[model samples]
Target: MTFDPVMPGIVLAVAAATLLALRAVALLPAARAGRTSVARWAVTTVALLLLVLAAARPVTGSAAGERNAQRPQEGANIYFLVDRSSDSAIPDFGDAPRITAMRSDIEEVIRAHPDARFAIIGFAARPSIDWPLSADAWSLQPAVDALTPYPGIDSTEVNAAAAANILRYQLISAGQQFPQAENLVYYLGSGAGESTVPQGVFDTPRIDDGAVLGYGTGPGEARLREIAGQLGLPYVPRRDGAELPSDRAPESGTATATDPATAPQPTELYWVLTMLATALLLVEIYLTTRDLRRTRAVRRQAPS
Candidate 1:
């Protein structure tokens, strides 16, 4: 048996001992018989021990189960192509910064597709993977939260074709890594905003699934819609109550997606321990009250 004590074992031991000692001292001048006093002391000690056990939080499982907790499975791979251009920092989205809106949208998509693994590509002058593909959604939070628009790069001069090429490369790389998973790309930006694309070089890459999600309060939405049309992907414009279209990714049904047959299961035993401790406390209370009543009855029977 192993113990994962909430507090240090020595600290709990000292607390239990100190409490019992204080109780023993309080009960010394009582009119109860020696055996009754000892019985009360034992009950108190048992109650204390039960409480400590509950706090310790014991668990029993094989070593193999823990090691396989994060088993990979077949699901969609979501790639977030986020634009961190200087234009994205404009504070017009819901009267807040556009970057704020982008973060919210990315998180919303993550929650929507619980089964899918995710990667993040932050694009300004050029696109690069801020976060690699992983099933752990929380791993991408810090990078997104700390996202700031790159300085000294004019959004007007960004090359859309070059940025798209980087995205294509990352998507192909992720596809190679997880061949079984479907690729879904979510573009969170006002696409190609004032970014020049040389004539005959505006070729849009083929995306298997997902849409171009536009975020702005200006003419960028029109440009984004054009980009989406060219890429043959659906366009979702930012609005007060806009929703991502249904064709993006497959939804997780009633069953939890993470817990596939191959994944290990984690079982918690804290609730059982807590219940046991509560039962012990009730028993201790009953015994103490009964002993007090018996002592009072004996005193009443004695001559005064």
Candidate 2:
């Protein structure tokens, strides 16, 4: 059993204690008068405790199972290095902006690897991690959709390898953390940028699969192909109305995808605890009402 409290543990504890203390004090006079039975007080106390437990959001699972639930099972770790340079806004691929092709290709990659963990790093004048590596792949859509090219007027020279160092560090860290998981890198760009390809940046064996998807027509297209060759990834050019080929074979073991039947899922006990608390509260209410009616009858029978 574990707890993922809706509120801070200390705050919940203090609140529960305060409520329990107040309830005890409020029932003291009734207890002395014999109007509130010990059973009623006991039931209410238990109910209050149960209510607190429910709020704490308890989950039942083994420690190992819980850890497994948090970590991605044997699946690819996909890193998307997107160029948000001013050139990316140039409408060249079938009269659509390079960003449009980038978005489409990203979605296609995501769909191709449904179980893969995804991360996004967008670069223009500089690089920034738009999203961290996570199993929730669909959550990355909004971030990708919101990407806009860096303002042309104020834009500095965007280099192809602007995010190379960051990508290297992330790949190393990910390799260390999840050695069994394959690391895939997708570089999406118009390839119209200063060629600052760092030496041996893509030399790491961590990169297992992915591609360099170039957009638009320019002399930089050759540079993009060079970048793809250095990374030992496929180079796909997005020409007029050209879409990414869908026939690419899955590289990793598809059978290794996390099976829902065997996956460790936290058993939420909050609702169960809540139901018990409700039942106890109802019993407490019934007992209190019975005691009130008995007191009223006794008062009526007494001489003035």
Candidate 3:
């Protein structure tokens, strides 16, 4: 229940006006006669409206949220660790290389599972959070769109270190509310030869997460990237080459990606607004009926 304003002031004003109007209507004699408690009704409407508006969370620009599945599913929290360092610039995978392809893949993943709380992180010579764990894919998607290969300092950190950082953050944010079996990590990197973090970092007993995918064709080929501004800085070389490590045993995991067409689309804000309005209307109807009953009782008791 948070509100970000693309037009915060306007939304607040509208909400306030609506609340006042409801209050005025509730104060009228006909409306007043039927309520168990008008004050309580007014307060409840306001509270409900606030909750609805909080979902609005107006942003300066359009943002997307994942729709509920046709079959209800509890959202799984997942984190993404990306290799954004200078090395991805090696024209590694796409015509533009691995970074762009990786970015596109991320956007697709988020588009499909927009409701999933996710964080995007970049590791090169070092690690920095591109987007923290959030349900509001509104901001998170943009963070994905803004992925660039341009120069930042030179510091390459291992994907494991980044995963560790992501794990730490998830624990802090979810706290007691954390769902068991809810957390997963996807590390999409070249698995560059050397990194400071332990190889089993994602395999520990404390957090039984494992790296899902690796990109690049040859040995040490996956680790290629450059931070030059030609592709606008932190670009992975332009090649479609990727590899599943020969050393590790293969297993089916949740990290398998969906086709672009079949991927999920975002839930529209207006639909949410409509549902909220419908709920409010139902509440109003109930209140009206209750009030009518009270008025009838009053008349019955009045002198004929």
Candidate 4:
């Protein structure tokens, strides 16, 4: 069980206490005048408490269930190795720059795997991790959107394999940390540069699934296919109006929809609390109305 309060704990506690105190004070006169009974006051108090508990938003789940709910399907980690080389600036993918297509595809990938953790690495003059691995998928949008072409003056040549070593290191570390998890690598680049590093740098067994998304129809397209082949991943060319291939399905081993452990756990008990509070409030209202009517009838029969 856990609580995701609608407000700060201190604030909610103080507000609830203050509300109960005020309600007691307001109804004291009615209780003393015989218009509201002790039972009525007690019901109202319980109702208010129930409302406060509802606002606290208690969640109930077993330890294993909670762990499973937090883990992505098959505990997949998606890595995006983007090319920021000067060739990426080439406006060859249907007049738009390669970065534009890369951004669109990255966004689509993120949307495709809402539960997967994501990391972004951009390579240009050298390799840099633009975004670390995070479960908050949407948070990578700013980093992806900010990617630009590497300055042509910074380096004479663009090496697509510049980030291969770093990527390999990261993959090895990820495997160590999560031996059961799958690593999906998506390399988005124009692949215009020569392979300065040795081949098979990205052929590690850690990469379980992914594709090399080539953005332009330029001469570098062939080189991009080579990079894909080296990584043992499929190469998919992105054109202006063509739809992306659906080969990158979200399903993984032991994480299928039929698996009870992978199913979404119920994490909210607020609605049940709210309904109980409402029922108590209705009971309080009925009792109060009945008391008031009886008191008025007795006064009418005895005095006027």
Candidate 5:
């Protein structure tokens, strides 16, 4: 984990040392009780260590962006904030969903802006980064292409907060002001129903990455057509009042579009798996607290 703060690990290690030292002062009964004190101290220290590691913000195998050092690139730092909720999986035109088309468009932007660094943000199932800002279009395209909205994370409510988070992440990763003041900040999803941003993240400075590549058209309606009941998918338009339809509108419900069941889209979601590992740890802490309380109660009842 890369520690951005001054000696973040050292500070955390020192804090742990201090806690161990503090435990040295516990009452004799607890301290001397059958290695109970030693075990308690060890457990607490490990928990603190884990939390510190997360706060340290260690990334996955340092991205080359750190070494890139910002050379002159042609396009601006282009980013995509995609909706990975259930709706993204539905069809848009032929067989593919609007989200699929959106990813294709993003890749096109990456290709067109070869020099411009790129990053992606998944807004649902926990807002996070799919890849760091970099110029490698090949790597970036796959990462963008494989994204699938996590189960139960669909939010049509205009999530400016999530969008802002996406915007901030891209610019910061690029390590400069966005658009070079002439480019665009892109948002891809349905921002039609959301009324309020609870965290007020929109108030912050946001680079307008041009227009919106919204996934679905109207409210509650996400449409896509099948390709002759075959393996290909094309765009199917949804005429909803909330969105400004894309120039490449989906064919009407009656039109016959081709559905090419393209290879199953790949989504790199290892981070979500990491969070699962943490749950076991929470159970450990709970057990520790329960045992500690039971010991105290037993001591209280003993006759001196």
Candidate 6:
């Protein structure tokens, strides 16, 4: 049993005991004649005790159940690995830069999965974590919105070595960061460039579910498919005015997000305690009033 009290449980217990003691001192005289005061005290004490217990949020469950209650509801982690190479700045999807389209797509994905955890990794000359694994999607918006093309590179192509290295590192990091969670990786890029790293050199983590999402319909599209094939993930290419593949993104209104950590579920036993307390209080009031009326009738009938 667990009790989450407004004040410490011990403090409430002590206060309840003190109040009972004071009530006994005031009501003990009636105990000798009719035991009425003693009955009232018992009912009042029980009611007050139940109130305190309810306030404490007493819960009874197995150790494992209790542990699960404290943790967030199990959900998938959706990690976005975006390309920040110079090639991403190329004007592709309807006059807007590829990065612009990527950012909009990322936001759309975020809005689609209101309940999922999200992380962002941008790779170019070097791969870096734009946002670590987090439940707060709002915090990731600025990073994704502020994405700029990596500068000072000799070529406008994606750096294969940097992309591969960053991808491997972020995958390993995500595994460490959320070991128990299921992860879905989304690789967003043109897939047109070549990495100097040899094939099969970079280690791809065992991803549970993912998709390789490519932007633009240029030469890099084939390279993107190749990369997806190499990684054993499904490839989905985006074009101007085309809908994203349904399999890659979730539909609207299907997000099942977890409530805040401290929010108790409907199954909590506090409600039962409250009901019991109310019943006891009502009984105590009725008994006390009846006893008072009986005493008054006895006094009125006595010789005076």
Best by TM-score: 2
lDDT of 1 by residue, 160-220 (tens): 4345766667667766655655677777776556766441122434467878888764666
Per-prediction TM-score to the true structure, in the order listed? 0.56, 0.60, 0.46, 0.59, 0.44, 0.55
lDDT for each residue of candidate 2 in 182-264, tens digit (9 for 90 to 100):
88899998665444543223555558888898887567788788889878888888776676765346457555544444445
Off by over 4 Å in 3: 1-73, 150-152, 155-160, 194-200, 203-211, 217-304
Q: State the lDDT at 108 in candidate 6.
A: 80
lDDT of each: 0.67, 0.75, 0.53, 0.74, 0.50, 0.69
lDDT of candidate 4 over 1-304, digit per residue (tens): 7775655699889989898888878677757867446667777888889889887767676643564444443456888999898767878777888888888888887877655668899987578988877654544788888998867524346667667888888888778655666788899987755434432345555578889998766566887888888888899988887776744554465345324455454456877898999998998778779879999999989955
Candidate 6 runs further than 4 Å off: 1-73, 194-202, 247-304
Q: Say which candidate scores most in lDDT.
A: 2
Please list all clashing residue pairs in model 1, or write none if there are none.
Answer: none
State the TM-score for model 5: 0.44
lDDT of 5 by residue, 161-242 (tens): 3555555555554445433322344556553233333422332244433444555655422211211011122233333223
Would you give me the overall lDDT of model 3?
Answer: 0.53
- Looking at candidate 4, what is the lDDT of residue 238? 82
* TM-score comparison, 4 vs 5, better candidate: 4
Q: Let me know the TM-score candidate 4 reaches against the reference structure.
A: 0.59
TM-score of 1: 0.56
Off by over 4 Å in 1: 1-73, 196-206, 217-219, 246-304
Order of candidate numbers by TM-score, starting with the best: 2, 4, 1, 6, 3, 5
